[model samples]
Every structure is written in structure tokens, then in C-alpha cells.
Target: RDCARPQPRREVAAAAGVRAAGVRRAERGELRAVAGFFVEEFFLGRTTDPTDRARCFKSLCADQSRDFSRRYGTSDSAMLIAEDADGELIGCVGVNFGRVPAPDESSADGPFALVANLAVARRGRRRGLAKKLMAAAEAFVREDLEEEEAILLVDQKNVPARRLYERLGYKRRWADPDAKALEVVDGSVVAQPVLNLCMRKNVSGSAGALVENLRWQDVALLAAIVAGVAWRDRLAELADPLSRLLDELVTAIPAP
Candidate 1:
């Protein structure tokens, strides 16, 4: 099932010196603004040429436009934005549903609600805008998309981001420690890849995951359970009297 309607706008309290912000799904009219934010925060630093900036901005807008249509059209993904009281775009995050292929071929792969492109403007820093954006993204995944878990990648060098995600209940997942992703640097793809840490959170409240799709970690856990049971039975055989006493105690209990 898919959720076609985007969430309504939600107001978030700002920091003491910062303006209050509102978060919601980006509209078609705000596509340029959304693209501008990415260029300003991520691309501008790479070059000083206005021509390059323009090209980057156009590329980002086109990419985001496709994303926007996919969300409202197919309900499979969304790009969320946070704007200050003045209606200036300050932060953004994206939630997408897809399969993240395991870096190691031997590992398992499954569908997940992926969180990506989380960014906040310099003016919006220290105002908790990132957290608000994150909250909104997770809400879309959980309430709107009916997903149980979400995953994201954070640069290990970004200590603050990592700390923030950990505080939000995201835990480290099994991933290639040396994995790298292609990154845009200087308005172009750089030869070097960015290192990242894989993190995951259960958005569904305390609900056990269905075993329909199992990861290698799940197999390991099941193996541990089996080994534990085998060891317990072996110990019970070595302690026959204790086992018999426990069996007698169980039999002594009256059936309701």
C-alpha cells in the first residue's frame, strides 16, 4: 500500500534566538527553492564560477522535480522541506523506499525506507531544524508509508550528525566499514568516494519485525538461540536430579 497525500504543515518551535520553522512536503512551486538550498549548502563551496553554480542549480532542480513527481504521483518517496517563519527554506530531508544492495555480495538485502540528503542552512544552524526535518521524514515513513524501519548513512567524520542520529534512537548496522559512495565535489563527481556509517531505526513502536525478509544478522541471532538451547539441554542432562526436580515442580502445578 502507498500513501498518496503528503502531510500537512507542522510548526516547530525554534531555538531562543532563532525563528520558528514549519516542515512539510515540498510543493511544485518550491522546487526551485529546494534545489537552491542544496546548491548553496553542498555545491557552492566547490566552485567560484557563477556559470558552474547555475548549471548545478539547474541539475539539482531537475533532479528534485523528478523526485517531487514520483512522490505525489506514485507515493513511493518524498522530499521534505523546513521553512522559517518568513517562508525562507532553511532545511530539507528526503525519504525514499527502495532496496539498499549490500556492499558485500554475501550479505542480505531488503526493502527499507531510506533517509537521505538531510541538510540545514548556516542561518538555521543550532536551532534544531535538522532534528525537526528528521522527525518529519520519519513520520512520513512510519505514518504515511506504513513502514516499520528506516535507514540512513552518515559521514563518520561528522561527529555531530552521528551523535544526533544516535540520540534519535538510530543504531549502527552491519555494513562495510570501508564502504564509500560517489560524491559531488566542485560541481562534478570526484574520483574519491565519501566514507559513511550505516544506521537504522525501528519506526514502528515495539513491534517485532516479520521474518518475511531476513538479514544476515537475523540468521546469526537465530543461530545463537539454537546454540543456547543446545547448551541448556546438555547442562540439564549433566544435572539429571535438577532436571527431574524441575519436571516434578512443573507436574505438581495444577492445570487451570
Candidate 2:
């Protein structure tokens, strides 16, 4: 029992009738699934051109795998995958450290970690797996990487993910201008693209102050639409209520 072999610290606690473990480096097979999940979930939606989508998916998969290896293998990146007792990959979280430099020259400044490609299998949702993976990622950044801050970008439409990140102390930093314009074209909002907001949170700072500075009304509106659709069988039945809720939420928060 006193052998010198290094062991991975169990990053997830048992919950909801399941126990989870962190996937260690050199686990190529699991990484492939992680890559595949991103391709299917996020990238797939953005590409309409079949050829472009195919190329993008290929590039993404290869790049992601390489990225994972470079990060985990070299200790420059931190990734935590949650697996059930039966050895099934249920969820994963990844943080790319030092992706951006801090604006201030403070040694207390942490690496600009980009959280991406997080996914929990369909059947594994609501079991607190996502939180566990995120906690592990945060611990790695805070403790192992000695980072004082972490950052991530979530789709403006991903209300659930946004809520989860917020609960975990992630705030919006800045929204993509292009994404804002696209939303307008898609008939989501009439506001100028330049006014789009990005939320950000300093992991070491007060969560309330961080959230108070950003515009999360859009997210709230989107959440209403999602909830309406989930409850009603048709969009028509939910359209008016959803739209009204969006308007109220957006106007509820003044520009800060």
C-alpha cells in the first residue's frame, strides 16, 4: 500500500446512485468520445454547408485530440472526465491554461483558462455529474496550475449551461459580436450588435458583483422559450408568452 506509484485523486463523490472517477491521461479511447460529443453537439449546429461541416468536424476532432494530448500530457492543460462505476464516460470538462494573458501585471493573475467541450451523456443528466467535473477543473486550475482566475464562453442560447457556470462562479466576459448579429438575423433581437454583452466572473471575487455588471436578461428570455417549448407541444402555443417574458426580462435589467 506504500508503493511509490502515483495515484489519481478521486475528484467526484458518489451521488444519485453512482460513483464517478476522473479519466487519466493516456486514455485515448475516451478522448475520442469526448471529441465526438463536441462535434455532434456544438460545431454541428453552426455549419450548414455539408462540405464545410465535414471539413470542420474533421479538423476539430483532430485538433481537439491533439489539444487534449498536448495539455494533459504536458501538464499545460487540465481535463477531467467523469466515469460511472461501470466504466462509462458520463461527463467531461476541460480547461486550456494560458490561452490569454492578463491585462494587468500581477503575479496573482491566473492563467486564462478556456473551458470547452463539456458534455454529459443524455442518460447521465441531473445527477450532479457536470458540477463534479467542473469542480475538478476548477481545483486543477486553482490548486495545481495555481491560477487565480478561469474563463469560458458558452452559447448565448445555452441557458442550462450558463446557469451551471454561474453557479460554479463563471461570469460572462464578452459576447461575440458576430453571434449577436446572427441572432438579430435569426429574429431573436433588434438591438445593435455592438451592444451585445459578454459576462465574466473573477473566480476569486464576489459572484453578485460579477453578475450585476452583465446583461443576462437575454439568457432569461431564452430560458422562457425553452421552458415553454418543453411544456407545450407546439411553438405557436408558447410564442406569445415566451416573447413577452423575453421583453420583460431584457428590460428588467438596466445597462450597467
Candidate 3:
């Protein structure tokens, strides 16, 4: 059956292993997590977004998210987030649709769509949340916005994100001849001039395809939940072990 397109968009897809991924619209309350994420990953590091401080995170999310909602023919243009049952904001992505500049005349002056603000929190790393978010965004662009392709930009230094994009069937849509350096706001960049690459995936005729990605964040969240449930009265007894495991799981991910 075709996935029904409606105002409150949410989708779930099956993956290869035990992990299942779902995609859906961002709730009004999740603004903090979404903003904090951008601050932690982009602003804290190096990003081109005009706002460079955590104090500006909420306003930035609102403005960009508002524009995302207002874009013609793309309700999926709004930000999307992935989370665990504990309501943790596991990952997020944003979609945009408008008249994007075409490199060659052959491409139509399009209401082309782009995906931005893609990330999973550092502690929440290794979960395939990024893949699921992109897939759902592409599906919305194809079916709802009636677009054929979804576009995104990746920093050359962000090799991990680049690899995930490639695995999801995104190809080199365009490459900047003169890419700008990756921006690290509250954070530091060891080098200057990080290269930016554009990637794209075809969304035509692809919807309701289930995908799965194992997430350390998911695992950690679930373990914490289960332990809390089984040992509600023994909270103090489990705290030490849980803390140790959490640290181990998080620090193990090779930094990107």
C-alpha cells in the first residue's frame, strides 16, 4: 500500500538487523534539542550559519524551520527528528525546496529540494539515524513535493557524514570548485578551508521502504530504561555500572 501523505508526517522503515528506523516531523517541544545539536556540532565546531552562539540557537531554529515550513509544495521541508522511547532527540535533518541555481542550462529552474542540518549527537553516535532521516526526507520530497531529486551539502572534513550519504545511494550532485573552510564556532578547527561537496538521491517512486540502523544511543537509552524498570527501588545500585557502560559506548566511536 502507498504511504499516506498527510499534515502530520511520520514514517517507520525496517532495516537489515534488529534496529528499525522511523522518520517524522519535528514537534514544537523538540526545538531545544534540535537547537542544542546545531550548537554542539555545527556552532561549537565550524559552520557557516550566521548565528554563532548557543544563546541564538532557538531563534535560528525557528527562523530556518519557519522558512522550511513556508516553502511551496514541501511540508516535509520542516525539520525532522529521530529519537529513542525516552524522548531523547537522537538525530535530526532539515529539508529545503526552492529555485536552486542550476550549474548547466539543461536542468529546469526547479523547486529543487535540499537537506540540511543533518546530525546525530556525539554521545548518540553510530546509530543509523542519519540514514533514516535522509530517506524520510527524500520520500517526502518525491511524493509530497513532487520532486525527483534531493540535494545536500557535506563538508569535506565530515568524512563520516559523507560516507553515510554515499551508502544511501546519494551521488555527487555538484562539487564546489572553491569550497569554503568548515566553520567551527565555539569549537576549534585544526585546519582552514574545509571543502564542501553536494550530494543527491533520487526520490521518485520510492516510499514505504523500511530501513534499519543500530544506534548506540538507542541501545544506551533502552538499557537505561529497562534497568530503571526492573530495579526501580535499586536505582543507586545500578547507577555506577550504567555510568561506566555509557562512557565506554560513547567514547568508543572514532571521532569524525
Candidate 4:
């Protein structure tokens, strides 16, 4: 008997006659590439205090690679990663099989794939690396399971994410009419603070795309908050105005 692990076919985009981003189905255990950079920073500032922050972060980081272990990188699910020519993982997408019971009892629960844990490194932003990862996940659900649609929950406040999915072809579909709220797990001890909007995309034959993970917008908002705090000395003069601006910026940014 002969045995050699199959290498996922790499797809590339050509721009100016040069290969841009490439995407592939990450084999089992490849998720470590994602946990290394994306997960670490994603959880750093979310914890409450200095003493326990690192401890909490460590746990959260490990969860990224382990949460979907049932099908992660195996035949049952897809862990697609987008990398540069240097083989660095810049973006990742997860698609796991499950059932999303219909909004009403009119139809029984059918095979559905849940798209989650999408992340893209800062260096890879605005470069279409995310779209690449999404394409791979959709393909897995469509071709592997012969499913027509994949369902995902997006934070109701995340406009960029909503717009991204809309561009790729997902829409609200909690019922025959209105989308419904879903109380999803937030972390080790609580449910998400805000309602998660239910969205679905048609992928049975040919269709497209979809983390709520800490994003660039969050980093910038954090920076703005730190800067405003630093200006505490000028409270009588510039502090109020600067604080107002920071408030607006914070409101504009969606929570992860």
C-alpha cells in the first residue's frame, strides 16, 4: 500500500502578471498557524485585569484551534487558510457541519454548515485575503456535503461584516420573513452582550461568502481611548472635546 498525504490544490490570483494571495485547505493541525498571531492579539485586551489577563488570554487562544475539533481540517469540515507566497497564514475561515432548525416547525432541521472564526492579519487587510478563505469554506460545504446554504451569526452591530457578507451573497433568513436573534456564547462564562444577526448564503451549486474577532477598527478605537485618557491633565481645556470624539469613535466600532 502507498500512502502520502494529499496536498490541497492552491488557487492564486494574478495581478500585473504576478501571483497575489493564494488559498488552500489547511491539513489537520495547521490551525496553529492561525492561533499564533491572530488569536493572541485578539484576546489580549479583552480580559479584565493585569494579573489574570495573560491567564485568560492563554485559554482563549487555545480555544481557537480546539473549538471545532470534531471536524476541523478533517473530511467533515473545512479550515481554509489564505497565505502569502512566503507561506504565512494571513486569513482563515471555518466551516463545520450542523443543523440550524428552521425558524418555524414547518420544515425539519436540515444539514447546515456554520461559518465562524474568520480572521485576517493586519498586514493582509484590504487585500482580498478574507474573500479567498470564504470561497474555500463555501466550496467545502457545497461540494463535500452537497448543501445549498451555510448559516452564520454576525454581531448585529458589525456593519463591515454585514456588508462583507452581503457583497458575497448572504442575507437575513431566520424565518419565512424576519431574521431572529440568537444568544451565542461569548467566552468562558457569559453570553454575547448583543444580539447576533442570523444570516445565510446559497452555496448548493455556485454561490458565495462570510469573525467578530478583534479587528483593525477595534485597535484604532483602543488607541483613541488611551490617547484620550493620557490627556486627562488637560481636562479644563481640551479633555471634554477629545472625550466626545472618542465616544463617537467607540460607538461606531462594533464589539467582538
Candidate 5:
């Protein structure tokens, strides 16, 4: 379910300063920009292990594209792009509607649609481009692909992203149990042990529940954990201090 086809529209609109949208074939040239966005902007100065970041992105793209092609066959996966008036690549979001194979132990029926690998360039940050891309992706899934629901994973600490997802009617479906947990230690928290939050949004239901479920304290703590781990990769050293802080905060909360 991977599409390796070249999408000339993406290149043309990206070069022409107009907002371009499509699920056309991805070209080799497009990979350079996509890879660059993840490496230079997304993981810049954050990861201690640069090689690991590179490997992760490569593996993610390969896996996603393969699934895209396998399921759609003649149809390509959707990749929405937003460029500034100058025609530079400002934002990009990829959508895959291919079904994922159920695990051996799972009883889930067929494959599910997933939206992943969303990134917007630094200068393009703050604009409503991400929202537009999300809407388009949802529409594609519901109307075009006829999927009942769409799912995505976000870093537990990415506050802005979490907010965006919540606003878009997505809810925290589950926490990745295998993900490393963050704890406080010393006077300052150390990095390492990151967690990922999984979310799902039904296009047809009320989107308000997602926002109501968000707790500011939880979001802030998660953000801190993500920042610490993403920047320094040391978490155990911060666990003790964080635990104390958590205890204090818990005490401050009015008992039910």
C-alpha cells in the first residue's frame, strides 16, 4: 500500500506560491524536502542521537508509504502542502487510509485509516495551515476513502499539537504502555523516557469531549517531560524531584 509515484502538482504548487492539495504519487525529489523538514526543523538540536532520528524518520516514511500503496493500489496517498506567497514549502501533512493488519492476538476487524508525519516549517508555525490540512485530511478519509474513523499519534509533551488535535475533535484514545515514563529528579528534571499519546476522532460526533478531557496540569507536565527528554535524554536524574512536585500538587487538589 505504498505509492512511489511522482506528484508534479506538489512540486509545481510548492514552487508557485499557491496552496496545493492532493494524494498523488511522491517523487524522489519530494523526499529531500520531507526528510529535511524532519531532520533540520523537527529534530534540530533536540536529539542527542542524530543517527537515531534519521533512522526513525526513514523507517517511518518507508512504512507509511508502503501501507499507502498496498491498500489504495491505483489511488495515491494524500499529502497536503501549504506554501507561502514565495512558493517555498511552508507546511506538509501526510494522510494514509490504508488498513493496518491486525495483530495476531487482536480481534479488530479490518485495517484502519491513519494520519501521521505532520510537520510545518518554523516560519509557517502559528498560521492556520495545520488546521486546514487536518480538515482536508478528514474530508478525504470520510468522503473519499469512506473510513468511519481516523487515528493519529502525538508526542505526549507537544502541547500545541495536543491542543490542535483536541480542537479538531480528536480524543486521547490510549497511552502507549511501552513508551518510557517521565519522572522528576534532583533540582531540575533530566530528559529521556518519552511517552506517546494516541488519539482518535470520529468525524461525525461532537468534538467537544476532546477539549473537555484536557487538563492543563497534565499538559504542562507532559510538555516538561517531552522537553527534557527531547533535549537532554536524561530522565532518571529528575524523577525524584518531579515525584515530590507531583505529591505536593496532588495534596493541593481538593479531595473528591
Candidate 6:
């Protein structure tokens, strides 16, 4: 949706086929695994040159270590991870509750959370880990951090990532006017015309109120009521009591 007028913010899509049960904020012990995943997937996966790869790995390792340390101690920022049933790390993402480092003129001037460094393993691809990670991050932003908006940057050439974000309610509103995309040609570095697209989503609505705020009993009761409607034709006797139970439960829950 880049180069188009702003559209209404969409709800976060439900995750499907994720191997891990859920995503959680990273702990200190998981720092190494998180760093290694980023280096392998984002850095090492990009090049075949041994020297460049080695240097880049070293540099990225230190940078990611410092970044993890910085975000771990802060209450407003977090690095989230998803592990498989075997306890092996499979997906990771980070969110920082603050203003963008350098926002473009066309962007909003208010503070917004930035979602960064989202990565999924090769084996975990096509299994919905990314969506789960994003849902949790946005939940943290709205329910935990109490922020109204979330933004992210993706390379213009990375069509898959861009499409995924769009499906998750983000729109490519603008690009960082001052940012440059660079590539090493034969021997010299040249700047490309494609800028990093800054996509954003508004997360202030009550899209996930029940999932985030309701108790287990409330959810179960609601689910049972919905299911009861399908069987109303066969067993008309149960419909009235189910309706009464739903009414009682709805009255008990406070309005937002």
C-alpha cells in the first residue's frame, strides 16, 4: 500500500501453524542464541566471501550483544523470542517504546513504538512464527506499554516481509527522506534509489479486548454460547439458559 492514501488500521491477524506454543520476552541466558540467530540469518546468509563474512559476523555479534544488554535492563524496551518444543530458539523480534530515531517529514510527530530485528529460522519459515511474534509485540505495545501506534522499517526490495507486514495491518506511509540504501558494486559502494519504507499501524482500538483482558471463565462461557447457537436448531431447550448465562457474564465484565 505504499504510495497510496492512508487506509484504516487493521487488526493483527491470528497466528496459525506456529511450532512453539507462544512467544515471550527474552531472558539474559537467551542472549547468545538471539544474537547467533540474527548473525546467521541476517548477516551470514547474505554473503559467500569468507573474509567479509567473518568480519561482519564479529562486528554484528558485538553490536547485538550490546543491544541485547541495553534493551534487557530497560523496562520500556524488550527482545522477544520463540522456542520450539525442544527449547531451541526459532524466532525473535524487538520493540522499543519511543520516538523514531529520525522520522520523516511526512510522518506523525507523536511518539510511537518501533518494532525491529524480526527474524525466523529457515525451518520455521511458512509456519506462522512471524505472525505470532508480531501479535505478541503489538500486544506488549498496547496492553503493556500502553502505546497507541507501532512502526517498522523494511527494505523496499524485501517484498515478502513488506507483504507480511501489510497483511498484519501496517501500511507503507512513507520512507525516511534522509536514509540511503547502499550496495557494493564490483569494487565500489554505490547508493541505491530505494529507501527504507517506514510502515506503521494504529493499535489503540479494542480489537483484542477479550483476549487481553477477560478471564478464562469469561472466554469459555462466551465460546460455549457461540457454539450453542449452532446446535439451537436441534436442541432448542438449551438456547434460553445459554442466552441468560451470556447476559449475566456480560453484565459482570466492566466496560473499557
Q: Which residue pairs overlap in candidate 2's backbone?
A: 171-199, 171-200, 172-199, 172-200, 173-199, 173-200, 174-198, 175-198
**Tens-digit lDDT string for candidate 1 (1-256):** 9976653344234343235688988765666567667657854555677877777667665775566556433457778988776677778888887666567777556677889878888767776888889889988988988988898888787798888887677877755556664445666644454567778888775535334234556668899999999999998787988888899999999999
RMSD of each: 12.9, 19.1, 19.7, 20.0, 19.1, 15.1
Tens-digit lDDT track for model 3 on 136-217? 7887777776787777778867788887877676667565546564344453333356456777666675452211222345
**lDDT against true structure, model 2:** 0.61
Q: Rank the candidates by lDDT, best first.
A: 6, 1, 4, 3, 2, 5
Q: What is the per-residue lDDT of model 6 for residues 17-131, given as tens digits with 9 covering 90 to 100?
A: 2454468888777776688787777656657777776666676678777877776547787889887765667788988855554564665645668888889877677778889
The best candidate in terms of lDDT: 6
**Local error of candidate 6 at 143, Å?**
1.1
Better of 2 and 3 by TM-score: 3
lDDT of 6 at 4: 59
lDDT of 6 at 124: 75
Give lDDT per model, in order: 0.72, 0.61, 0.62, 0.65, 0.60, 0.73
Q: Residue 245: error of model 6 in Å?
A: 47
In order of appearance, the predictions have TM-scores of 0.63, 0.53, 0.56, 0.60, 0.52, 0.65
Q: Number of clashing pairs, model 3?
A: 16
- Output the better candidate (4/5) by TM-score: 4
Q: In angstroms, give how far residue 179 of model 2 lies from its true place.
A: 5.9
Q: TM-score of the candidate numbered 3?
A: 0.56
* Deviating ranges (above 4 Å) for candidate 3: 1-22, 28-33, 45-76, 99-109, 179-182, 185-194, 206-256
lDDT (Cα) of model 5: 0.60
Task: Give candidate 5 misplaced runs (Cα > 4 Å).
Answer: 1-29, 45-76, 98-110, 180-193, 204-256
Q: Please list the residue runs of candidate 6 whose C-alpha ends up more than 4 Å from where it truly belongs after superposition.
A: 1-18, 49-52, 101-106, 180-194, 205-256
